[model samples]
Target: FSGTGTNMFKEEGAQQGFSSVTKSIGFSTDSITFGTIENGHLLLFETSSSRKLGEGRDCAYRCQDLESGRELALKMYKITNPDQRRAIFHDLYAQRSQVGKHERIVSYERVIESENTIFVLMELLNGKDLFDVICTEALTEEKARVLFRQLLEGVQHLHRKQVIHCDIKPENAMLLGSLEDGTANLKLIDFGCSCFKEFEADSRGCVVYDSYMPPEHVADSKLSPSVPTDMWRLGCTLYIMLVQRPPFHNDAQTQAGLAARQAGQLFRVPEYEALSPEARGLIEQLICGDPSKRPTCDEALNHPWLGLA
Candidate 1:
């Protein structure tokens, strides 16, 4: 909700779509603690830290697990209506339960539902998301490849489990570890728009930016949203990671993206020519209009660009 990104190429840090990423790395000391052990449920926030960690439909707070004493982030959804929330995630709880946890997916520890809120307890991430990295840090194709490969691994896991992360983008993926001093690993996060089946997943559930969606999303004919949507999103994400801009702008530009997607002209940006052919080729294939032509995560991982061989 915070991003007001423009469709122009001049402004790099401008956020043109939905602001789903947690851009705040630091928290404010102003804090309040709300919860009790007497109620058999308690979430404590230390005064040394800020209560709210991120922004969006839900807010994350630094909290501690009473039993384990381990630190964790508590994602609180204010809307208490289960049905409304389900309309956004489509059996959100059930689907996530099926996906469970993975090396690349954020691990959920507990789910607590109260009369007015839904609280999800997850492992605390120690690094910035891909969006922030692209904005603030220096990125190289090698580093992008490192993160993209892990991202593909995570999505591959979801697809293998018959899940499609409709909201695949730079914002939805985060890097683990101290980015300044070490090689950071990627962990896919934010399952608010994730789904169990391609057809069952609703675009409404995906707070998708116009540019991130595939051409199929706009077609009027009979078509159910599918995992291929995720592939298109991946292409957009990868392109943004390397070029510091989404391949498609939003609204009008997205319409242009459809044409480019059909023509295989997605790599027309000036910055693209400087990139290695393998990298550009993979991006072109991923952003192609035909879903059948797009490579699966398995095939993408083995692509010459990723250099798995």
Candidate 2:
């Protein structure tokens, strides 16, 4: 037998068998189907010439809904091992309820299971991610408040439903227009890590980017994501938007050590401060060492920093 195992990749046109596995360009339109489309087949296209969006373990395809004639993003997960695949598929299925459509959160269409893979259909977004938007300069107080209000509204919706977005960061937040335009809509995406957890609870270790991971998350090994953890990460994300860098970010050579140190350290506003006292105070409260001290989503929405109080 060949050493190559069963791995899924994209290719153009239709074909079958192991040789087709070498198709390096686009996914086979034949094998992929969400279900029987009354209008026609589900047509798939590349987001760019590269034929994929983003990098890492996840693969997303830009497709058109034949019936609705709307653009959608298909997030595919290729898991060959049966056990691992089943676990992932079940986890996503279980969390399906948590991904309800919301104005602030990216809309999740449905989950598709085909063979050993899983496809997550979501609303295709246009414009830039928060990381790209905030990388160069700090956001103006007005713009920051607008974005923060929208973000909190979305998070509040999730928290009310007992869904904790375990991973909340600038990269997870998408902007619809240029930051300068002031009319840009912000939508929080990537709910794959989200799960149900109560406020001030502990969670397991699934944090990839520790800079934004809260002390409670880093300290607790058994706890899953909690409301306080999400709020803490939101605080870090806000700090990045206002200052273009995480509050605990450092130039230290050892990133892991730095992140561990930051996770254990009490929250502090860095010297790169630009926001007013109220804004800083709000951030301090959000990232307070103790999870119970952080404000709830509604409380945060009405915080004086956003000038909404």
Candidate 3:
């Protein structure tokens, strides 16, 4: 741990219903330190460099409680610019507030804020993301159905709460466990771009995965995340789950190739055609270029292809 603070103690108190009794643990001038406490509780403290796992600006560490033998993931975000720090903190708080008890969303355990860095404690997803799953295996119809159903449930939950997951993509959905459990348990994660917007302000800015964006989003840069926008991305995800690739293939080199492809290309539902007619019909309705024709979450839930009946 490199960014621990006295805040975790206060947070623990607050969560235990002691809102007024705020106490600070001792702090170090150097990077915070994390270790296991004697009572078996994992103590995540801050350290100077925090253990570096991989590349990227995010700093992370693994802590084990000496007493309990429990482990935890501690992440610290180094805040340089005050404005950017505020924005990131705001986003984190908003995400925490919006998804209070949603099962499909990642749970926010606690936040540690110091002068130079902020630490967010979250549930570490154990399985691979949907992106890796798709890249490794050719999804069978049963597998696709199971995953898409869970994805739809998550999207529907967000819509019902009036939150738009601006960035919907394979990389953002995590597989919870093995796919052999009759369902490919999936969890929708990453809300850095999610927003709560009024109907009038819905069309302000484009926020989405480029390959999954709809024609309207590509055509109008003013489009904001909404039910339809999510649907379009869901369509793309389903297409990928079934076909092992996006409907429109764009090289990583092109800046606007994905948007261009989304704007002009026609996607033939190859995966659907190989499945039952009901499944094919559902895919057709979902991937329709015209946003008005796309099925809403509720409608999709009720679709015969889902076997919801």
Candidate 4:
């Protein structure tokens, strides 16, 4: 009776005494074949099939909720090492409790736990990612200003909740559909590496996204993942949005080597000469190598380039 059928939920539920809610809503039972952790499983629903979302270390799926008729993003982690899995689960629980309500931050819905799989369901954003859009077309000054302001507002919102989104690259920023009145907006997603201020500890365990890590993060472990680190990444992202390239391109193999190149002030804005002076000035202040000099999200919001009307 269970042979990869579309209406399996109906027949299977009737035999078990499972209510219609469980059937209509999707839940795995004995009839459902569970896939191995190493190969992972592709979530399939009546309306949609899972699609690979990103690169490195983690796997994500784009799924559709048949009952709600809405799209959702699901992240699955297969941790075979007991210690590592425990650490990750602890951090996930901490993050689940700390991330407060914010429009810009992605909303976490529910956690599904099975014997071998852990799934986190998140809201699906419709518009293109900021990284893809900027790569295809350089953002106009007006457009960049609007987008950056929204970015800062989102970061500021996170700071208010004491959460530091250690990673703040363009890939993490999603352009949610324009307002009903037609104003474009962006939403920040992917908080796998995010940590609250109070949760700071040794940094050796987690895998960090390379291009966006700040100098302090590379230099010292005691500095703690802070608001400034996110600012440093914001600067780097803005630079790329305007010029279509990162400030530094050392091709270094290690964080220490990259740190050394950055210390030499190897990155510059020669490509951005055609941009407005205010834009260039803001970029200078943002990518200023020294973490102390970098502007906080609040200050960046007030910068002239982002303040443009």
User: Quick one: best lDDT, which candidate?
Assistant: 1
Question: Each prediction's Cα lDDT score?
Answer: 0.66, 0.63, 0.62, 0.63
**True-structure RMSD, every candidate:** 10.6, 7.1, 7.0, 8.8
* List of clashing residue pairs for candidate 1: 5-15, 5-16
Give the Å shift of residue 232 in candidate 3: 0.5
TM-score winner between candidates 1 and 4: 1
Off by over 4 Å in 1: 1-50, 79-84, 87-100, 178-182, 198-209, 250-257
Per-residue lDDT tens digits for candidate 3, residues 170-289, read 988889878886545788876656765532254354365455666666666766666877887787777778777676666422546545444435355565457677766776677676
Q: How high is each candidate's TM-score?
A: 0.76, 0.75, 0.73, 0.74
What total of clashing residue pairs does each candidate reach? 2, 9, 15, 0
Ranking by TM-score: 1, 2, 4, 3
What would you estimate as the lDDT of candidate 2? 0.63
CA lDDT, candidate 2, residue 143: 81
- Cα lDDT of model 3 overall? 0.62
List residue ranges in candidate 3 displaced over 4 A. 1-69, 73-75, 82-87, 98-100, 198-206, 250-265, 269-272
What is candidate 2's CA lDDT for residue 171? Answer: 88
Please name the candidate that would achieve the greatest TM-score relative to the true structure.
1
